[model samples]
Target: MARSINQVAVFGLGKVGELVAILLADAGFKVVGLDAVPRTMLTADGVELETRPLDVTDAAAFRDSLRGVDAVVCCLPFHLNVMIAEAAYDAGVHYFDLTEDVPTTNRVMELSAAQPAAGRTRPTFAPQCGLAPGLIGIVGASLAKQFDEIRSIELKVGALPQNPTGLLGYAVNWSAEGVVNEYLNDCEVLRSGRRQMVPAMTEKERVLIGGIELEAALTSGGLGTMCETYEGRVARLDYKTLRYPGHFRQMHFLFEEMRLRDRRDEVGRMLVDAKPPVNDDIVYLHAAVEGIKAGEPFRENFVRAYLPLEIGGRLWRAISWTTAASAVAVVELVADGRLPGAGFVKQEDIALADLLDTHAGRLFGHTTITQSERA
Candidate 1:
């Protein structure tokens, strides 16, 4: 029998976590929000989510909490994901998270391969279900399917302030730690039809979307497991983070000139301090694939800009809602028996059409496509 998910526990309860809980509840699932500190009731979009205090690090307590829930979504930091996933595994529940940490995801994949519950297949383990790795990967794969042969697949995502300031011209809208990791860590890519690791923040390129000039460069974890999945299939497959012009230069100076590469935590704090998050933010997504379709040379591009909008009676930043909704959409798919019930779930394997069919996934439906060129 396939696994059925009706109840879910969302761990973290931050800006994104609370929204995830609300979206799940709005989707007709019983939802609970867990956090390290105590939290009162949270309601949104005509749905109320039960909230509780729990230290996810407490393995016994976390495992116990997962007993009644059909699935668990971890919105905690990437470092805490493996611990939370272990508890979910022991409790025999489906697991999902928004982590871009490669090592953490590797650990989760190992857990998914372990023994299943008695008379049932193991629960699904899906990670990197955020905007870049989650929605962007789905888009890239969907475009790749239309081609008989693929030469390259390029993806770019940026969550930035609509109005920028300072030399960086960016805001700390997302996790500063994750941002630092993406900059300092080595990025995985498929070069010349072989898997290769390249330095992040290198190979800078100019990108124009809807007449907006931006810069893009290699970013770690944004590609998720696509490199491994599309290694021999595509000659060039890579994901990059887009930023306003001169943002990468400032970052290069911070990490290279100041030599803060080894001190990621401090760098995160410093960056957050310098550029706090702004309420008015926009998310830009650009996905392009080149290959042959029906024996004809072709290139397809998906480019859109997402702005903050009201959800659950409150306005949410573009970064927060997009991330939360993407993850919730995946959970909805798994619950409705559309996605696999067991083993690790790769974002590339998910269908974009199926994703947009869900309630949460509808947020991506409004696209101001600046480029849909086919040649």
Candidate 2:
């Protein structure tokens, strides 16, 4: 049964979209999904969604697909998000996307200014609502609020296999192109009281979570709004993704020796064609903030774990659930007026504590909010 949907549209039915669409329908919201390939749009109940084979780049068809829709969810690849976001802005529907591409996100934010200046046709615009940047952004920002002068913020997040089977011990849960784009792209970081481009896969560090030791490195795009919000106020800030031991080493080999960094397309195609898929995975988050407290340095740390969940009779790996569920939960929360009414909304705009209180993200854990380390 599709439940009592008010009519929502989801673009893309890959892992994230499938999980989100089913949950939306189950919650009684009519959902229409748009994808270039018709076979990807799964359906249910008389609440059959209105899916149209759309190239998305064709603005005419894209805008037309938004007809009679109140909200739009994008599960498309990051490169494909710009067109859909433009269409959603034109259609005046609340827009949501799962993109970690900073340039793309900045473009959307620029467009957010034009919205509401015209009218409140669209109520909200959220970019980068997936796991790393989205969840970690919220967590890091929340910690920064405690300090009088925010000096430094560091956030680390990752998606990895629960059990290993290969040289990399990794499975491609989402987009291989996205993974390549991030690893090869110019990374952003705040060093020495200034933001600068840092090489990806450097500054490797080890952490213990859920009693399992893991390694973390400077992969791109997890720092959602931290740099923007902190800016000159903070001395140093950065974000990285975490993975199991030896994962970074293997990635370096592929990107360096195999020269995947130079020829991303060939490497992406190779990985897409060759990798073995796995079901079980885990999403890990670690964030810390330091600033002046009573003329002295104070710090706060937070960590959480999210595992797999079964949706639509299929097991949603932790990456799928963590990424999709964060967006789903935020959309539901924003719909209910639990968040801001209009303009660009950052992941950090919503408090971490309140988000965890919600039933959706709580599936992760109670989560330790405040931990101290001497500086």
Candidate 3:
């Protein structure tokens, strides 16, 4: 009965981009899916849409495409989000992206700060609107509000294949570079109200859920934008990625002893060579909030069971729906004035309850499960 998002533009019609377009289009929005490699994009399973060939690196061309669009949902890889986000700002379009690049997000934040606030006619900028940083930030922030005094918040998420045919039990569902880069980078963790950097694979733990044995270890970007939002409210906060058993050890060798961390170019090349890619995958999310509740310590958790599903005849992995839809929900919310509607917006700025009621975020509501079931 309510219309918030009308005109939409999705940049980069890759594996995830196609799904994003179909879902938004299904929501009764005018959607345009653009890509640099037009040859790589094909019609999604259930929807019929035209693809605009775009070279985002060309500043003028990129801005020209943004004209008259209310919000731009960036489905491009992490590297391109920076350029695309800048263009969105210059074109006076609200921005939403799936970038987990800390540096890129920081730059966007800086740009948002330096630029003049939006007038009544322009859209604001909201970057890094994916599962981990996007949904986790919103959901975790919601749980925090229920507490009298918060202690810590930990968010862990993984976009993996629902059904696997290989030993990794995984597929190239998302960005391979994003995966390898986070694995190698020094991760940030808050311990006792102080911020510290921890090695990616150093802190390992074994977790079993639904009789499915898996491993979770420290990974950058999984915490999303929670670190800045939770600042002093929480004491210890960190994020990890869930993987099948023994997967950590195998990657430890490839990234550490084998020096793939130092030679990621070679490592990324090997992944392209060895592992086959697929579009069928699952997106896993786990977030826990601990704090004092009525003079008692309590924890509130959110978890979900996501799998690839068919929408409008096209099938896409759970990650595509969860990540893209969550970002789009925020875009819609901001457009409708449910959010602040101007300047920089963070994922946590969204109210989880309101988000779950929206069309795009309702996708998360249907796929969700209890924390114990997903853990």
Best by lDDT: 1
Clash count for each candidate, listed in order shown: 1, 4, 5
Model 2: how far residue 302 lies from native, Å: 1.8
Full-model lDDT, candidate 1: 0.89
lDDT of each residue in 189-272, candidate 3, tens digit only: 888877778898767887655556678899887665677767676898888888877777888878767776788777776776
Candidate 2 lDDT over 1-375, as tens digits, reads 221216789999877887777666655567787777875434333345556677877867778888888788889888888887777777777888888898899888977888453653655788888886787788788888888898788898877777866677677776888888777776788777677888888898988876788888887887766676766788888887777788889888988987667888888887767664567777778888888877787877777776677555566788887777678777766766777756789898888777766546555563322244455
Compose the digit string of candidate 1's lDDT tens values, residues 192-218: 999999999989999988888999999
Residue 193 lDDT in model 2?
A: 67
lDDT of each structure?
0.89, 0.76, 0.75
Task: Order the candidates by TM-score, highest first.
Answer: 1, 3, 2
> Which candidate should be chosen as best, given TM-score against the real structure?
1
Using all chains and alpha carbons, the TM-scores for the candidates as numbered come to: 0.97, 0.87, 0.90
**Model 2 stretches with alpha carbons more than 4 Å out:** 1-6, 39-52, 57-59, 115-123, 292-298, 357-359, 366-375
For model 3, how many clashes?
5
Pick by lDDT: 1 or 3, better one: 1
| Overall local distance difference test of candidate 2 | 0.76
